[model samples]
Target: MGADREGGARHRPVRAVAYATCGVVLLAGCASMPDTGDLRDVESTPRQDTQVRVFAMPPREDAGPGEIVQGFLEALTSDDPNYDTARKYLSAEAARKWDPERSTTVLANGPGTAEDNQTGGREDSGNLTYTLVGSRVATVDAQQAYSPAEGPYSRKVHLSRDPKSRQWRIDALPAGVVMGKSDFQRNYMSVNKYYFASNSPAVATGQSATVADPVFVRKRVDPMTQMVRSLLDGPTNWLGPVVRSSFPTGSALQKGVSSLTPDDQNKLIVPLNDRASRAGSGKCAEMATQLLFTMQNLTPAVDSVELQGPSGKRLCELNDDQAVKRPEYLYFLDGKHQMVRIAGATSTSAVPVPGALGTGDRELRSVAVSRDEHTAAGVSIDGKSLYVTELASGASLGDPVVQSHGATTDDRLTTPSWDSHGDLWVADRDRANPRLLLLEQGAGRPVEVQTPELSGRMRIKDVRVAADGVRIALVVEKDHKQSLLVGRIERDEKAGEQPVVTVRGQRSTTPGWEEVTAMSWAGDSRLVVVGREQGGVLQMRYVQVDGSAPDGLAPAALPGVKTIAASEDDRVPLVAYSDDGIVRLPSGGQWQTVVKEGSAPVYPG
Candidate 1:
């Protein structure tokens, strides 16, 4: 099913405070009596399937130093909107200086506290210190960007007795909130902020090629308002170079606009400040389109978005269909090793493409059609040679554009992929001399792309370049395990010098999977991955580029999936080669057999 349709069904509104009492049970485990003075193992309480609202209690009068520290740490994981209760455990000056929004540090387990001062126990002492320690898992920056982290984490919290009340209070602490992995997952959700590809020709012509910049935001905390603010604030630091926001510079939501809710008709009206009043009709429409795409995953599904100026004048409006693209044709190789295509998601019959590669004159193992659908690149059955051919009836099979010298078929070239810029990319798995090559416009000498981050025994198993031409997803093998990673593509094009293409900032997108068998870009920032976790059965799930799962349920189970195909346009059904033969999952429908003998299914790039 299309991601949008499936997401709508999965995102229906649920009570936010369904399990209010559960918070006491979860947080009580972190606290200790004033007399014990003992350190306990810190662990995260498992999250429930439904939304949970955790309310934290304020520190009691005359609380001991250990109790104050534990109360503050437990409060960090609560749903207290402004963290007011958490601040109660801090001194007056420290409470005023603390900024919980600075950044969030996630630990493998919840933070554990240990008394650092060696002085003999004395209630008369005015000062104390405690050590907070845990293993780091990931971090969320001020921009709401999530990045996986590793290694040990250690910080200090200082406490002092209040001269007026003679109560223990935290004098100093970390800048932002700290929590365990489970609490992080429960408190924040992954959201994709839409932007236009900065380098695409479509942008110059007033058209848009949508790109997704994923970020994390607090759930049930007026998320609609947060998402709108994030969209206007622009893309994150890592993706800022390749994408551009449609909102005008200095544009922001109207002052004092704390909550944004869609109307009964599911139409959202966004009121912008005076800075956006100067935007023309065309630019306003583009801005509305960006919001429309960004709000697709929200509950009740916003059917339309309208942009309003400072004076409450409607500048432009956009509907869901107007902002989303429909799926194109589905391309694949038949049992006879011929490239064929179906019209679209609803088409029942498949026809051989009008090209030399479809005539079966030259046997092929796998094929990739260019984004424009004018040309195709195929790898031989033995996987030694790579050929490019025209999609014309009279065209002839030409000479091999590239060849591999691997000793066996399994070590030869992988399936080729095309970027939106018409460039072709493939990885030669030759153990003796492996390399990633890029062919500009699918012709001429292939250039070896630089991947300095992929050192050691890492080897590329599969490659899929995003439609934006600036990001590439690769399945790499290391130590007999397969992992999916996404990297940025930077091209240095000088008029008189050779172009140098490099892949940098590679990050793991499926760290838990032991084997990533196959994957395809299912949406702007989402991929449908087929893989298995350690000692687990193979399954298919949609994961964002940031290694976080999306909001909807996973795709229905399929057996022995060898290859999968999906389009960036979510309107298309997902096609896969499985034990049941070629099957498709239609929107709001089950997987149905498309053909009994097809392999290597793919959609136009």
Candidate 2:
């Protein structure tokens, strides 16, 4: 053994018994055991109701190769800050070469060792090899980006016994760490890394719409510092092209400043390197805003963030209230099929808006209001036509801007969504020819948006454009199952040519759900989704655009949900159409009936 040599000798007598007892308790609590088959399959460990702190114990004297390997695997999942105890089972050289933070491989279950498959020389030769195997679930890379992974996983662990002490030690092993899905969830949490939308027109106006890039970081392992570093590192590869960081090129945290904590007043002071000092006051303020938003979910909630240059001079500061806008009214169809509005956070009663659509001139199916709240779009009850009109009183509903030729309502147009740029987007699911269309300012000729991956068996079921106008969330159907996908919105404009638009690099944001019934953008990069896992009941939860589960408890469950709505400003209550008709969930409150009959609840983009 490596560092365990001294400690192992001193505690061998006492810890040996304790380790056996702990092992028994852990095994008893396991949901299922690994079977002795060609592929040893172990179920994920059940999560405990209360937090359990597990400490790693140094290896006992003269441990066998199997014991050393098992102990090392167990230690990797412990609460050890630096995994010092895990290294104790490795050879000195192997321990020095290991880099646990390189990446994390999550498996459906804890890895199982196959002792029967052990190879290499006999015990006398002091050389042996064992295999650890499991089914891969996902991976968190060096940049903290999380991606779902599939297929079987197998790795070899080589061991050699010290000739003098005759103690088995790992001489070679895989880099990073591997653990069951439950353990991974216990150790890691998702954080949103804010970035400016590169293609948004708002950026040119100095407003710079923010887009969230979610990443996973260890929950108890200096997460504040980890999140800061991840933010400076830029967006994940999938979102890189559509977003830009406000921090100057090569900007980084001041060297040797590792841990970060908010002060008693909930202010976090960040010290940046020389590169950040080059930014002007305006850009520096944007950078501070990014930090304020990124750190908003930390425990106790950071109220403000202040950035300092290398020379310890203040660059800028931003408070939470100044960094984000307050949510507006909740919009939905009333019992009479007329559009109605209510205060998103407080109103209990709903009233029709001042417009032709609100006056019930034409029956509506679903609706979307522009970000400016100056205009509105509505789909026909038959899902065949889309109508646009102003929100002002006496404003007339114009002729259908777009229509679908589908034979039935189930195969026609979906609810419309307006982007920050005032553009409108929707999917026409006509069985003969399904297509996604976008309109300029909600009035121009529909542009057929290209979606190469959505052909063949897949078709768009619903559409929700993000506030940044650079991303779109879509519910896609294939073989009767619906999946939520987030795709980058790419626009190509050339002189004298029709501006081409495409939804590219689409990735599933609801990998765990077998069917996604409805979803809405709840924040810059978060969505409130109503879905169900295979053979599971329908449930509502918040998920990041990057396919990672966000921190905090999931919303209290509501049954029979048909559609859901959430505001970019999270302070707004969530509204949904369910068996009980229109229902709203206020902050820290249960679902309350808003009306006996209503459908297609929504918040302005």
Clashing pairs in 1: none
Each candidate structure's TM-score, on Cα atoms with residue i matched to residue i, is 0.87, 0.87
Task: For candidate 2, write residues 207-226 as lDDT tens digits.
Answer: 87787777887655567888
Residue 546 C-alpha lDDT in model 2:
73
lDDT of 1 by residue, 1-605 (tens): 11222434111111122222333333552265342334454566567543556667788776788788888888887777789989999999999999998899999888876776554445567887777889898898989988778899889888889888999899999899998988887878776678887754452235656777888887746678888998999998888877788788999999978778779888999999988878888788889878887777544357788888877888889876533334357888888888888886777698998868888577788889888788889999899999998888978778899999999987999989998778899999999998999998899999899999997699999999998788899999999999999988877777776578888889998876799999998877789999999899989988778776566678888888999998876667899999887899987789999999888998877
Taken over the whole model, the C-alpha lDDT of each candidate is 0.80, 0.79
TM-score of 1: 0.87
Give the distance in Å from residue 196's predicted Cα in candidate 2 to where it truly belongs. Answer: 0.7
Residue 493 miss distance in model 1 (angstroms)? 3.5
Question: Model 2, residue 88: what's the lDDT?
Answer: 92
The most accurate candidate by lDDT is 1
